[model samples]
Target: MLPGEFVAFIAALMAVNALGVDLMLPALADIGRQLGVTTANHRQWIITAYMLGFGAGQLVYGPLADRFGRRPILLVTLLGFVAASIFAASSQTFAALLGARVLQGLMSASTRVLAVAIVRDQFSGRQMARTLSVAQMIFFLVPIMAPTLGQLLLVTLGPWRYIFYALACFAAFVLAWSFIRLGETLPVERRRALSLHTLAHAYRLTLTNRFSLGYAVAASMTFGGIIAFVSSAQQIFVDEFGAGDRFTYLFAACAFSMGIASFANSRLVERLGTRLISQAAVLALIALSVAHIAVILSGVETLWSYMAFQALSMTCIGLCGSNFGAMAMEPVGQIAGTASSIQGFITSVGAVIVGSLIGQSYNGTTLPLAIGYLGIGLAVLTVVLVVEQGKLFHARQAA
Candidate 1:
């Protein structure tokens, strides 16, 4: 395969990672309405349930992938995802739908962690960073059109469940693709022993290693912050700010801007290094969070301001995000799957706490959203500062 073709394949697989998350965005309201979800607040749980499942299940995938290999594990999980998507499509009750969605999220997470592990198996340092950057840059197009696609599917097909049916189709394709094209990245000779003793040690070492945790935390928070926004964005924009379909497009614009940052990082990561660029980007996110807070305090609550500050924060996140994952997994090449699973677990734990808070706190305006952003930004930056050992590294180092 040409380099370009491989990149496309990776990007397509990566896009599947977002399917369970992004495709359901526009349906938040419909699901809530259809299920008679009385509380406007509880509606976000439809999304969060999936996240919680995805995040929690990540731990299992890494261990399995490390022990078994990426191809077989992903093959199993992707099939499970297809079945879960089918269950999600057939559900009428809120509990049933949420349960299926949670399973879908958990299963999809295996795919995601494996994709990262697959990268770690074949590349490291700058090469890994560059590959992940290209993959992420291309894959982000999923979120851009996801909500709009949801809306269109909802409007044209006349049932919100059809959205899951569409997701099932995508999952089926991924299942077939993996079986045909994915060889075992972690060969048996290289596989980690699937023992509780070794697994415990890996978790302990991952949590204790400053460099690994630093990069992992940086990656986690970057993603955690975005999850906060995603959980709240549709309501904040469509209900509070009134952008409707444009909200999806606006969110995509911010994502595309971040894609530009990731692309640029891909080109320079080998030259400058991951540690330097990630530190700088996190600092930028902190500043943007502060700016977002100011917008809320300025006595004006408007859609334009929300979009502006949100875009800024996300751009910084995009810049630093991929490198953090690459760096965290670089040293764990032999156990990349297990390591990637640990990485996902920690990140998801953070997201569940931080993201759940942000999603549940919306009070019919952008103020709560802005405040949440500011708070999370401060917390993440504090983690960075401490992890980086009392100073910020602002150099344009390569990954």
Candidate 2:
């Protein structure tokens, strides 16, 4: 594959995960109503369960990918994802749907882990960060478009299950594309043996490295804020702000800002360095969160104001995400698969728990969400400080 194709393929792989979540947003209310769910907050479990499974599943895929190879493991998982999506579409009960979603998420975990591992196989430091940012910029389009697609489907197809079917078809297309075009990134000599001892050593190396673990934790905290917003976005936009059908467009606007920020980061990361850019972004996030909360408290929050603040916050998140992940993986290049798995597990599971708490705390107001963002920003900053030993904005030469 050409450089552009590789980057786009990577983005397409990651976009599968984004589509699974975002495409369901418009159908959340319909699913709840049809499934006899009355509580608004409980509908969040549709997303939380998949994320939990996605996180837990990562622990195994990394080790397996390290032992076998990226290509085989990814192909198998994509097939599983297709089957799981079909199962979800066929669900007759809410529990059955959740079960299928967990299965789907478990299969989807391979995509997230292996995408990072594949990139890590080729790049490091600032280059890796730039590559990831570019890929993420493209991946952001799914979130920007998915809700609108979901709404369109609901308007035309008249059933929530069709979204699952659509997901299955998309995954199948990706699976075919991957099989025909994607090659194994991990070389034979670089592959680890499939042994308990090897797995333990790899995991220990990942965890024992303070830089890797700290950045992973910090990234997880940042992800929690994102998930919190996504899980509650429908309610906040449609129910609280009365945006109605415009919710999808509003959500897309925030996603577009993140996409633009990601593109900017990709272009600037090599010159400015990951540490400087990510640190400044985190600080900006904290300040934005504080101001957003103040506006909420002042009783002056409007849909437009909320959208503007969220767009800015999402931009900060976009800048922080790729850089943080690149830094975490920088120190664990040899164990990229395992390291990616560990970090992916931490980020996904932690985000789900944190996001779920904030989503469940919805009281027909934006205060809880704003407070959650503030807490997340502070927590991320604290973790980064400990990891860097109170250092900030330190530049490193490209590896």
Residue 38, candidate 2: C-alpha displacement in angstroms: 0.8
Q: 154-174, model 1: which lDDT tens digit per residue?
A: 789988899999988988987
TM values, all candidates: 0.95, 0.99
Task: State the RMSD for candidate 1.
Answer: 1.9
| Top-scoring candidate (lDDT) | 2
lDDT of 2: 0.91
In model 2, how many backbone clashes occur? 0
Candidate 2 residue lDDT tens string, 271-374: 89888888999999999989999999999999888999999999998888988899999999999999999999998998898889888999999899889888
In model 1, how large is the Cα lDDT of residue 377? 63
Kindly report which residue pairs in candidate 1 clash with one another: 62-337, 62-338, 269-398, 269-399, 272-397, 272-398, 273-397, 273-398, 274-398, 274-399
**Position 84, candidate 2: lDDT:** 97
lDDT of 1: 0.79
Identify the leading candidate in terms of TM-score: 2
Off by over 4 Å in 2: none
RMSD of each: 1.9, 0.9
